[model samples]
Target: MKKFKVLSCAIATTLCLTMAPTAFAGTATKALSVNTDPSDWDRPNAGNFVASYSAGDNYIYTALEGIYWSPAQIDNYEKAYGRYLTLDLKEDGTTHSLNGYSATTTLPDPKFDFEDDQEDESSTTPGYGRNEEVEVVSRGALSDWTRYNYTANFRILNSSANPYLITYASQSIPPLYPGGDYNNVPGVNTTGPALQGEYFNNFKTSNVSSSNSTKAAKTVGILSNKVEVDTHSKSKKAKVSKAYDDITNRKQLEDYKKKHRDLLDKKTSKKDNRNQKVKEEFTVTFNTPVTAKKIKETISKHNLKASVIYARGINNLGERVTIATTELTDESLNKIINSKDYSFKGFIEIEGEGSVADLNNVQNDAEVYAVETADTESTEHDIRPMGLSWKLEELNK
Candidate 1:
């Protein structure tokens, strides 16, 4: 796989094509007429066209100006399309209302949450490191009061997994400065950092487009934005990270229970030991081959609220291993294999408020070879276990 270089600080701050100098030809020879119906603005033979307001008001004014046009024609065009050609002088989150135009709103600062890693920045002792979060944020002054264009300090995000995600929102209002030289805008319009995470080792791209149309003689434009991310992360295979065996027959089930007797009986919770309240792992045999996609769909269909942990070709001497945050009820299991000719044999780990009683409710042919409960002192696990974090790229593909 070819390694794409990370975007330079300059390009990252300015985002993409958005910061390029605005270019427009000479003013229209004939005075441009405004189509109050915005839908006609993009059609062939439209008097004058401005690609997008995102390019800022200067770009819009230049694009509509014509080299040859009488004062009457210019007045007619301005009066007709006054509402559509305007800009909000203020970029703050507050709503600004002015004469001859509806209230306008500029994009607000992007919001983010942060958690302090157990380290002190002001500890006057040697070998103490400053908090990465605070250092990155205070590196330089934010671009503007709105603070839309700033650093992307992602100390809380897992970048190597799937970096470069962007979200945007917008609302429409009547023109704020019709025929006014309002140049500055906020959000994607200003220059600032685009990718500023600790592990920004991936390629991120975005595109923005706009379209206008007339409905009930009212003008309306739809803006569409998209984000694409590509990473060099490798695909993880489905294999039991922690050693576990399949208990097929009654004797093996008994032997397995005896081997793990202390772990099942002990009440002490330890992070490294199997006594932790982590996810329950097991193996299930199906009447027919099932793909990872099918397993995911089944979980969603039944509202299981469970995830497919490890899934690939059969292993453990032909047992399909699976793990989930919640217990898989026999009722859901039966529905999953409905009319598939039951060959469902598996092992289960019951946690608080769960028991073999519900596991016994599987289909008539279903067989549960072994069952074990987690330690009494085990606490619910928040972080996913190793090899369980699925790649979003694979899921999308």
Candidate 2:
């Protein structure tokens, strides 16, 4: 397949002639006047045509200036033929007709008169109120926002294109003119002769006229607005990135759980083997402050190895201290719980190979007790197990 370079305004002009539709000279013989400059139209900057693709609705919106004699002329046109903008779009080497206008059968709000402030501001300008025009907005479905040539029969291209070329020509359409007759009306002879045979051939290639042709062929160009198109792609990328993050986080958590299954199983086992005893770990937290001296004394009395994993101030609980120790016998636990020196205001939680009886006794003796399982999983997994799942469901919803 041939790779045609994306046709832009500059590139399209080089490949084909792009005449400003309004710039075309009107025939002097015609009674009605024509103004092609979009700004000359009734609405502010009406001549400045704009093409934009909306991904949300999968449509292309085009705004342009339409000619009108008076406010009544616009109303009459709508009443007789109904307001519509004819569109011819060239996509993938073929032209498609997609015309659009206000969905309401009746004309909505018609901006007829200019604001008094605007007229006063531009009073010094030539032919101020005499220039009659109105702005027309139309939309058509677009499969993609990328490359496509567009042409509106009654409207000038906002910018320029090569695949679809638009040459400006206007004719006086009497009020209550029938629909689809705008293009068929004869163009009045302007002050200067037409450029067809005088300066360019029918194809606009060179200044040569063939006996069979009477005018220059219409030039074609694509319609595109780069900003909106880029935004569409960025939005798609962001959605994909969010989905990828959710899937990756969920997979990482599942993998981590699979690899650490043995550790969790051994911790939960009830067997009292020697290997289990050395591997056993439990955290004991106290509600009241316990001095290092008191902690050392308790560990010595019970013949248990102890390590202070967290200090009171460093942890969330101001006065609570956490100490890790090996598995303890039921007798030792009972002694520690009933000790007169120590208040035993906190509970003891076992990590591995501790009996349910021991857990019940510890819970019964202290205010609160909870098993602190070892988390070999990633920090993301440790925070919220259902975080990604919730996000996925939200996206689907």
Q: What residue pairs clash in candidate 1, if any at all?
A: 13-192, 27-66, 27-67, 28-66, 28-67, 29-68, 39-213
How well does candidate 1 score on lDDT at residue 365?
22
Error of 2 at 100 (Å): 78
Q: After superposition, how far is residue 77 of candidate 1 from its true place, in Å?
A: 78
Task: Give per-residue CA lDDT, model 1, range 185-236, as digits (tens).
Answer: 2222322111111111121222221222211122111221111111222332
In model 2, the runs with Cα more than 4 Å from the true position are: 1-269, 291-294, 313-368, 371-397
CA RMSD (A), model 1: 25.7
Cα lDDT of all candidates, in order? 0.21, 0.24
Candidate 1 lDDT at 75 equals: 34
Q: Encode model 2's per-residue lDDT on 1-397: one tens digit a residue.
A: 0011110111111101123243222111111123333322211111222232311221222222222333322222223221222222111111221212111001111111110111223345422211111111221111211122211211122212222212222212211221112122234323211111111111222222122222223322212111111211212112111212334354553454343333345544647654334432333333343444444444444333332111211122221222221213343234334433224433322122233333223323343222222333433322111112212222334
Q: What range of 10 consecutive residues in model 1 has the weakest lDDT sum?
A: 96-105
